[model samples]
Target: MNDALGEPQSVLVLGGSSEIALATVNALPRRRLRRIVLAARPSAARDLAVTTLTAEGISGVTAVDFDARSTESHSVFINEIFDAGDIDIVLLAFGVLGDQEAAEADPALAVEIATTNYTGAVSIGLHVARRLRMQGHGSLVVYSSVAGDRARRSNFIYGSTKAGLDAFAQGLGDALHGTGAHVLVVRPGMVRTKMSAGMPEAPMTTDANVVADIVVKSLRRGKETVYAPGPLRFVMAGLKSMPRSVFRKLPR
Candidate 1:
């Protein structure tokens, strides 16, 4: 393993099958990084993502099964990857957005959204963060959303979970300061992807490719927070400052 940046030339991605996650991996500088581990839920889509990565001439991209909800196995799973002592970068990109109407109608749906988006991430991410800290050098890239800035009536359940995740990432980033392990929190405005196909279009919608590109650029520059499309950072600032009485009346 080379130490061009004073760290291992390898990366481990926790939610490897995500479109944005895969895109970010593809965007990394292949000449500098030598190995990539793509961990995802045991699903056909995961296999497809692995195939796509291999086709990109990434040299050493592979997939492994990982379930975010199975908290009992997180330690063992993380150990297996870092055991080789070659991990230097990590990406946390697993998430789920259930039907908002259903989530509002059923308490169980709301619970699932919270468990999947926030609770599961907390369980696995903490473990990953600790491992990286122990190793004394790495970068953790987290995928968050601008929806987390505020809860809208249109999709508060999903938005609430994202909001929780965004907060968690920020706090984690702070805790890692001066530890040689850094967290990169990514906030994408609205991504048009398979998960969001049937949903109504939102303003400033960006593609997974755009988000990935920004992430790679941010990593190279050591930016702690990145807003995909760049302008959404200002837009979210405006959104957070608006009065709730006026915010609630505005259309999503």
Candidate 2:
């Protein structure tokens, strides 16, 4: 349950090692959080996240093994977590940004991207939503992207996955309306994270902490959708309205 200030007492991060997800957790009121569950693939990165949080004096930090592609086990995995205790917030932060050129060259690679980004999200997202509805009070923060606003030739495969995920999350949010289980869709432009490293910085590129701040603020304000850096919302709107011919001419 959330505290008097409406701060979440417990957070469940599906992509525990995600820099943006971890930043959002760190930005929260640490003193009020009773539990922090980092669910991700078994790896040193997941272990490091727990160790880092523990070092920050955040108690009850635990790590659980979670593979996004393993949709068959999502039901059981989510059930086990919810059975342990109530989860105030669930961050659907797991995704893979495969090499766009490689994905275009290999149909199998494209499938991998779709599986991890779209299929896996739908698998876990529904399970999380069901649990949240049962508890009757919680928020689901989904990490969408500006690229999804309109697919670009530069990264259409990845963009298509995000576009599907964005629509699915919005519909899920609507389905959960008045159920006390809400969803916040976060669309950020190119973010400066390990995932985007080596990529050319876009016009309004920002960092993970900046996006984290927007997420926390939006959660408190009960916003349904938010664009990090604030201005990206307007920017995306303009881009979305552009003719495909003009859009294609735009820089990569």
- Candidate number with greatest TM-score: 2
**lDDT, model 2, position 24:** 93
Q: How do all models score by TM-score?
A: 0.94, 0.98
Candidate 2 weakest lDDT stretch, 10 residues: 25-34
lDDT of each: 0.85, 0.93
lDDT accuracy of residue 99 in candidate 2 = 95
Instruction: Write model 1 residue lDDT over 1-252, tens digit each, in one string.
Output: 335653347888888778888787777777666688889877787788767767876677788988887778988999888886757778899988888999788999899889878998898889889988888878888898988888899888989998999999999999999998889999998898888988787889999999999998888777999999899989989989999999999977
Q: Give the TM-score (vs. native) of candidate 1.
A: 0.94
Q: Once superposed on the true structure, which residue ranges of model 1 sit more than 4 Å away at CA?
A: 1-8
As for model 2, its CA RMSD to the true structure in angstroms is 0.8
lDDT of 2 by residue, 1-252 (tens): 977687788999999999999999988876688799999988888899899888988888999999999999999999999999999999999998999999888999999999999999999999999999999999999999998989999999999999999999999999999999999999999999999999999989999999999999998888999999899989999999999899999999
Top lDDT hit: 2
Give the distance in Å from residue 236's predicted Cα in candidate 1 to where it truly belongs. 1.0
